[model samples]
Target chain A: MKKVLSGNEAFARAAYEAGVGVVSSYPGTPSTEITEHVSEYTEIYTEWATNEKVATEVAIGASLGGKRSMTCMKHVGLNVASDPIMTLSYTGVNAGMVVIVADDPNMYSSQNEQDSRHYARFGKIPMFEPCDSSEAKQFTKDAFALSEEFCTPFYIRSCTRVSHTQTVVDLVDRVEGPAFAPENNIPKWVMIPVNARRRHKLVEHRTELLTELAEGDKYNKVTMRDKSVGVVCAGVAYNYVREVNPEASTLKLDMVWPLPIEKIRKFSESVDKLYVIEELDPFFETEIKAAGIKVEKLERSLCGELSVDAVRALFNGEEYEVESDNSLPFRPPNMCPGCSHRGMFYAINRLKLFVTGDIGCYTLGLLPPLQAINTTVCMGASIGMGHGLDKAAEGMSEKAVAVIGDSTFLHTGINSLINTVYNKGNSTVIILDNGITGMTGHQPNAGTGCDIHGGNTPKIDYVNLIKSIGVKPDNIRVVDPFDVTACMETLKEETAKKEPSVIITNKPCIFADRTVIDAPYFIKEDKCSGCKICTRLGCPAILWDGEKRVAFIDETLCTGCHLCIKVCKFGAIEQRSK
Target chain B: MKLDILMVGVGGQGTVLSSNIVCDVALANGFDVKKSEIHGMAQRGGSVVTHIRVDEEVFSPTIPAKSADIVVSFERMEFLRYADYYGDNTTLILNTQVIAPPSVGDGSAEYTDDKVEEVKKQFSKVYATDAISKAIELGNPKIAGMIILGILAKAVHFKKEAWEQAIKDRVPPKTIDLNMKAFDLGYNI
Candidate 1:
């Protein structure tokens, strides 16, 4: 009964094992795979909802029906689902509804590094963060129980490390949990103002009690060692604190919000110094400090994301250090070789249009060579922000295009597009339909023609959807982005029109769908031209060997999608003749 | 002894089965072993790493990085992540694969082949090897991670029979004969 599981898969197995009857999720990184993993078990009903808010509401309804249900989304997706999340916290729940939210700390596969721990505070729900896959599984199984026990939705928060990292998880959680079903009660389920007002009190009463229960819950544990430095840490930070001062008496919290106040105070008093080591936010530290406990030093530097090295830097004892700085080295994530986004960025940049980008792998379009996108606010904001920027300029500053992924458009971009249509404002929204949601690890979206858990769902035609959203059908054009010339004409046409227009670049994610292209192609170094044209595609596989003064393609990384080949005017990007 | 070791590597390598053998041995040795894996974007040739920790009273699942005694990385390019969990006491088994991150693209930044050597200078005790070449020599070429895992076992007290049993237990029953040989060759390495 032992195996390896990533934090995402472990959550899925935990869902299955928890006897979860309903699993709904909007696929986002560090979160998308949870339901996909849960789907493996035939006992559970799992579906990839079109968007995060819809997924959350679906799960909420399931939970109200007396069956344990769960929904998962990335941190940004949480923003899309925030409306439901905030109110549901007031309505409370029945058979335990768990929401697994995966956060990106370094913005890997995410638009921003908004801390979900703060969200737990905002949503007024208990948030559990597991540092590794094991904790991910255990916490998920524990999440269902805690949700029902408190009669409120429980949050299992995950960071990129915890979500992406594979750890030794005891894989039995999938088979251990029992399927739960609850009896329907309209008075209990309905959230109308009259019933809601009573449920709000119930929610408040539960919150007040949950805070006190945190003091003795099994979720938080204390280990006493030297007792000189009592460090309060949770999630991955706990692992770091344990390593930094293994001898330091520690209070580790798995349930971050509604912190175990009494336990933190006792541990702080017992130890000589108090250092709360949690990631990103000052949640635990602030909570404990508010309880009137004075500490020797508040390690604020431990805020943001903490690597074991950062933690050990504070503790001089045999720390893990890479000696020489060198920025600790970072890999610049780039678009795969044949990325569909590349050809589009080429056109957008060549036209010198001030493009507003949305969250997706395509956001890499802003990187070095391309340097095209002017602004990247958040998910689904491209269209609205683009409209505002364009209207403010009033045709003074060239063409402004809002570039969003198909997944994002479906997530929340439609409303803004509708507003542009209703107001009769001119904003061209280009929906990059890469078939799969690329940024957050290629989770299926409404536009992907596939549902969560591999079900064949009706694909939302971005062109038709926008047309229905009030934009004229003629204003919406489905253009094959692989053809640069066709894209150029469409781009000009969409921008030239003084009305809301949508241009969906229809193509499968070349990396996800390998059949899109085959056989590796590279830039001919001997051609003696570093026009910097191919680099404009912003493909990660293409690198410049500064010493050699030529474009170097990492053959292993290239998908040969031919988007780069099409853009290289010099015939430099020729297909490798095997 | 029961060992729950997470072996991490890129997709083309044998990260799955190598860790499975380690987990299976712990199970066969009657040490209630429970191991799980999440293979996300694995097919995309991205950074792949594992967490395998074997202990007696292992309650919480993750190894907690610094708590890990050994971190076997199939590609040296991903060694930076090891700094999170790898401590002065941890042993590093790395493959000399020079696959660059997505950052080192056409216009973003530049990197040379010597990047792998530049990274090795950062580690505490580096065991570098041409695992791909060794795997090719093993007739499979894909079990490069297994060869690296083989080199890792040299530092730990894992029994050969347990590993053999794990390979036979975890792999498809059809490919058992070949995979067992692959595991044995890895064990010898």
Candidate 2:
């Protein structure tokens, strides 16, 4: 049956269909939903690991124990899992293992947009980039088979556009693949330096074989068409280029790393003008050019995010008509109103202390209005940076708050918190436990009090987890951010204390939580002295009556959180009667 | 003429779904359309707005904000956020809502009654709404966005029948009676 599902949903369904034994991932945008969605299948063990690295390791161990396993994270998250990913590349696996990395182009909810394909090359692993939801489902299952065949970990990379977009996919029953029947190759499995040295040769041999394997793969193929134009594209960019020129000769590669050399050369030789169209970086164009093919129109000059418009510009020729406009139309991305982070950010700013931020929708805290978070390097870096900054400050600045989302804290944050305590650093870590991973479409996390199957994993208590990390118990404080006076007072007290601390803000993210009741606060037209005191909260639900010079609240938006009534000293704003 | 438009907003008075109601009504009257939206991250007590432009032909589902005939904005600072999209001929329907951004430290920017008067300097015409008072009298404080939509329906290109039809089609089966009352409350001025 054909079903309309998101890329993440399809990914999870495919994994379950593959009868994957273990699912481990720390929630981050673009990729978080895959694991969460997969948890719906009761036949497999799916979970939100503490971080991406641990998640990768957990998947590796389970796969070695003869279970199909997979772990996923956003592109930046690959950096956190790179260590395990590299070693696993050498160890290979008993059962099929697929590591899915979701990349965000345009940095939608991300702090940065570093390509993960580079890491795949660095780790000497083969990578697959799926263009859409259906491909995300099928390509992942394909990666698993390729992984077991080569005794190497397979990678499937998808970007935000592919990860978030919904498309139709055919549904089939979950066919549990046979268990990883173990075969002894101690030299292959155990890589002690001497044995590892030997396996390194095997790894090299495996790469050659994988390359040969990659060469015949159905993913990397070309439509031998009009000799006028030859193009190499992959993932979403592949779709873009195709849209621009339907009849243009194309070489679309699913397996990007350790590229299918013979196939590329064949595609390159058949066409006259060779153009490479891939987003972010021209990894394909660079590699093809290196392989001694007279390349024409390589996107050497163009860089950054990929879009159909960009691809259209590259293939601009007589066949493609061009229309140019000089308007520099802009649509800058911004955060929403009544966001749980806003009041907390306002509180953080009041402290005037340096704060290292982490990934999530909360990363928008660095943006204006809430311009409170100081530094946002990557996932889980907040605590690390916070510790580093605290040591450098060396008692000068009163506090350093490592602000991280609940999902990010699960992704790679807890360890950094543990490390900070172990290193005897005096810094505070604020686990912004908004329940769901709001940055990447509200994917569930370990701290969310729920699990993949909607089955609860003992929600790791943030306060208790902080203690386990060896931070002093007295230092940990749970505060509700909405209660302004309490939140401000708690921040003041936490900063004054000498011990390292962990503040768990238990406010539900406004987007997800709808329990709150909003009593309407309409402005008094006649008694209304438009002092504008109510506007301080910046709630979009309220509007200023221009002609009469009075405050008005948009009823539709009034969550009835009633923060405005407290601020309205003039008694002009009052709740509407039922 | 019947219309159905969805405006996304957070807990703020300025961006309370007024533009969508009016545009949806306009579409209901001899118009055809559908829209997709993203209200993510905006509910953080920040300025929020989305455009739903309708005409005889709109191939794509999303509204390209540039040609928006009527721009309903709840906040002053947000004007520049989507400023490039507005043409010189665009009507800027505004609610002089100003909330300090993170960049504006407390007490750094002074506020005065003449703030909207100054803001009107840029726009060809600034139609401001005191939606709060009207909502207060109606015993529904959250009706400002609809009030602005009502004001626009009366003044702009959209016909009133389309607006009523849209409300008729969109209001829930259970709330149909209440909503007709609400629609009249919103635009019957």
Candidate 3:
């Protein structure tokens, strides 16, 4: 059957058809849907791991137990999983294992556009890049088979364009491979110095064999049209090239790693002039050049995504101007109308505390008019960075606060908080427990009392977790983030403390259950002061009428969490009568 | 025989759903369709866009610059936001609703009529309407996108039955009648 499927969805369908027994992942943009889709197939055991590292190890464990396993995460999540991936490459898998890493070229919902192809090369694993959803399914299924054949883990690199785009995919039936019993080969499974040294040579031999396989027409292909100009590209870039310059001969490399040196050299020789086209990094370009191929080096911006227009402009020797009106107001992503984080951010903004923020929806607090967060490095960097700031700068402990979400705090912030208590640091750590993973479309985490399948799971209690980590019971305070008054008072008391404090902002994301929605709020024009104090909350529902110099709520957009009512000292904002 | 449709709207304005309906309609008519949109942060009240191409064979999921056959704007400013994607031959189906961004609300930026005026002057085949008001009149403001898709259907060559079937296939069974009514309201407009 043929169906419309996004790349991530296709990957899941392919895994199902490939009879994948285990699927594990931590939700991240462009890649979260893969595991989410995988969960629909009851035959597969799916999980939302604490972080990418844990997810990768889970898949690794499943593979060692003689089952085809897969783990999917965004490019940055691969950084956390890289530790296991690098070593797993040495200690080959018992069953087929595939790691799907989706790269965000334009940093769309991501911190950096770090290419995942490098990880495939860094980990000495074969990698495949699919251009569209159809290819995504085919390549993913092929990846599993190739993994088992080579006795190594394989990488399937997807970008935002491919993963998020929906295209027609032809489906197939499940072809379950014969299950192998769990083996007890210590030298093959374990990675000690002696075993690893022997495994290293096997890894090299596998690479050579993979390179030979990549040279064939199976993964890499050459299309000869007008031989005047040819482009060597892969993934989404190949689609742009095909769209803009269809007449040009093309060398589309489905397998990005292992070089495909002979195929690339032959393709280059076939065309009059060959040019390398790719987004972000020039991995293919640099490698093609180093292989003694006479490919032209085109100047392309290493930032952002490559578009069809960009390819046309590159060939025409013209700059692709982004057609945008500067006069138009910018619409940056903001907190929702009744976001639970707003009250906490409003209080933090009022306190003017130096906040070390972590990843998730709370990162939006860095935007005005709240601008509460000061530093955001990675997943759980806030706690560690805040503690480091306190230790390095005198008197900073009293002013520094680390803000993290419940999902992220469980991911890596738990260890950082333990470090704070162990080192006797007085850094204030505020855990924004929104009950669900808010950023990546509300995937359930360890703190959430649900599994990937929405089945009942033991929820991790933050209060007990913090106390067990050496924080005093009195120092751990849980407050409702929607209550601005309580949030402010708690933050004031917590930030001023000379001991390590853990503040848990207990509120479910408004989107999680839509519980924040109530009667719409409105402003009484007569009682309103034009002070714009409610506007400082930066809620999308609140609008500032410059002419009237008064603030009013957009009833259509308002969720009536009564946050603005508390912010309004004049009692101008009131909920409508239901 | 390739048609490139660009749908632009605010994050929660149902642009993704409308584009999916367009894809379904195209597919029902035996055409290959590829649709692309960025999710995540862009979904949080930010300007969102979806590029959809329907043809016998679609290569890139994204429409090339200046080649969008039809531009569906769910909000006025968003039409101007993606001005680079359309040209003189493009037919624009615009929803005359203004959503103020945070910058506009905080008085850091001005939301002016000049942007809408610029869009009107640039495109000769512009079909502007208050779809949001029409949707509200139809009993739910959220069905505004179906109205815009109805206008979009007039610009494209798909059969009316194809659109109706596509809508029925995609929407919830209980709200299918309401959505179909909204689509007809747009088609009549």
Candidate 4:
């Protein structure tokens, strides 16, 4: 059957048809849907692990237990799972193990545009890149075969262009196969010094065999057209190459990691001018030049996404400017109307606290009005960084605190809590527990008490979890963040303490709750003072009426969370019942 | 005939859902279709743009600048934001609703009153309507996205039956009748 599917959905369907038994992943943009879609098929066991590292380990354990397993994450996520992935390359998998890493070259929804292709080379694993949804499905199944044939973890790289784009895909039936039984090979599975030395040699030998297979890979094709120029490209860059210079001879590589030098050289010889057209870093050009091939790297910005016109400009030597309307007001992502994070951010901003932020919707609190966060490093780094900042400076503990999401706290913040308690660092930690993972489309986390398929599971109790991390029960407090005065008092009391403290702001995200009411708040035109205090919450619903010197809430946008009401000192804002 | 559509709106406006219906209708009509959307952070009341192309054979999921044939904007401010996608021959159907950005309320940027007029000057054909108001008149403001989809259905030559079927296939069963009514209002308007 033919259907329209995004690259992520296509890969998920392929994994299901390839008889993949276990699928584990941590939800990150451009890669979250792969596991979410896979969970729809009852035949496969899919899960949302705590972190990418844990997800990779779970997949590795499943692979060792004789099942075809897969783990996926975004490019930055590869960094977290790299420790296990690098070693998995040496130990290898008993059954096929495919690792899907979606690279965000444009930093679309990512913090950094770090390339994952380097990880494939660094870990000595074979990586494949698919251009569109059709190839995404085909290459996914091929990735499994390559993993089993070479007895190594295979990589399937999908960028934002490929992962989020939707196109036509042809479906296939599941390829049923028996699960491989675990073998009692201590030298292969265990990595002691003597066994590691032997495995290192085996890993090197496996790379050589994979390179030989890549040479004859049918997916890596060279279309001999007008031989004036040869553009070597892979993944979505291939589409740009073809769109720009359709008649020019091109080398489209589906297998990017272990380059088929023999084929590249042959294609390089056919055309007069050799150009490596790619986005971001020159991973291909660096190796191609080292192999003694003459190629010209295209002149383009190394930042953001590549376009069809951008590629054409490089060939035609013409300047291409992407037309944009700069007159429109910049609408950056903000905390949703009625968000629980607002009350805390408003309190922190008022108290003038140095806050270390983590990833999620609350990261938007760094923007103006409630510009409270001092630094936002990455996922689960707020606690540790805040601890270090407090310990490094004298009297800093009284003014510094770490703010993290419920999902992120479970992901890696617990370790930071342990470090804070054990090291005796006097830093306050705030967990914004909004029930679900609020940032990435409300996916279930360990705190959500549900699996990927919406099945109920044991929810992680935050109070006990904090206590288990050695935080005293007296120092642990759960408060409703919508109450701004109470939250401010709690923040002040916790930050003044000479020991580690945890305050969990408990509220469900408005969007996550289906039964949420739309009791929009309106300002009393008569009792209105032009303080602009309500805008400090940074809620999109509140609009400052500069002409009338009053605040007006857009009824369509407001959910009546009442955070703005709490911030208003004059009692001017009131929510009207629907 | 090739039809390149650009959907510009704020998040939570059901832009993705509308584009999905368009793609399904195009597929039902037996034309090759492709659509692309950047999600994740955009869901938090940020600017969201979706590119959709339908042709005998579509190669790329993205539409080049100044190449789109039709643009369906869910809000007035979003209409100006995606003006780059408009060509001289492009047909623009804009919802006459303004959801102020943070910069506007904070006094960093001005929300001009002539926003729709500016868009009208660029594109040859502009159809501006109070889509949200029309959806509200029908007792559900959530169907504002469907109202704009109805305008797009009239602008293009797709099977009405296919569109209705696509809506049924895409929207929730309970909201199907109301959405269909919203679509009819948009189709006639």
Clash statistics: count for each candidate: 30, 41, 0, 0
> What tens digits encode model 1's per-residue C-alpha lDDT throughout A147-183?
8888789998887777765556666644433345565
Label model 4 with its docking quality class. medium
lDDT of each: 0.72, 0.68, 0.89, 0.87
> A1-578 in candidate 3: lDDT tens per residue?
87888999999998999999999999999899999999999889999999999999999999988899999999999999999999999998888999999999889899888988888888899999999999999999999989999999999999999999999988989888559788689999888999999999999999999999998867788889999998899999998898888899998899998889888888888899999999988898888888888978566888888888888888887887666677778898888888889999999899888899999888999999999988888999999999999989998978879999999988888889999999999999999888899888988888889898778999998888888899989889999887888988988888788899999987788877675679999999989889989999999999988888888889989987888888889988888998
**TM value for model 1:** 0.84
Listed per model, the TM-scores of chain A against the true chain A are: 0.89, 0.88, 0.98, 0.97
Residues A35-124, model 2: lDDT tens digits: 877877878888877778889899988987899999988887788888888888888888999999988766655667787888878888
Candidate order by decreasing DockQ: 3, 4, 1, 2
Evaluate model 4: give its TM-score: 0.97
As for model 4, its CA RMSD to the true structure in angstroms is: 1.7
Candidate 4 per-residue C-alpha lDDT over A386-469 given as tens digits, one digit per residue, 9 for 90 to 100: 899888998898998899999999888889889999999899999999988888889988888888888889998999988988
Q: What 10-residue stretch in candidate 4 chain A is worst by lDDT? A: A511-520
Clashing pairs in 3: none
- Greater-DockQ candidate between 2 and 4: 4
Looking at model 4, residue B24 earns an lDDT score of 90
Which regions of candidate 4 fall more than 4 Å away from where they truly are? Answer: A318-323, A515-518, B106-108
Give model 1's DockQ, 2 decimals: 0.24
Binned by DockQ into CAPRI classes (incorrect, acceptable, medium, high), candidate 3 is: high
Model 2: which docking level applies?
incorrect
DockQ of 2: 0.07
Tell me the tens digit of each residue's lDDT in model 1 across B1-189.
435354555544557667766666664555544443334333344555666656663433445545556767777656565555655566667777766554554444444446656655654666778777776776766666566666776667767666666666676788777666655565565
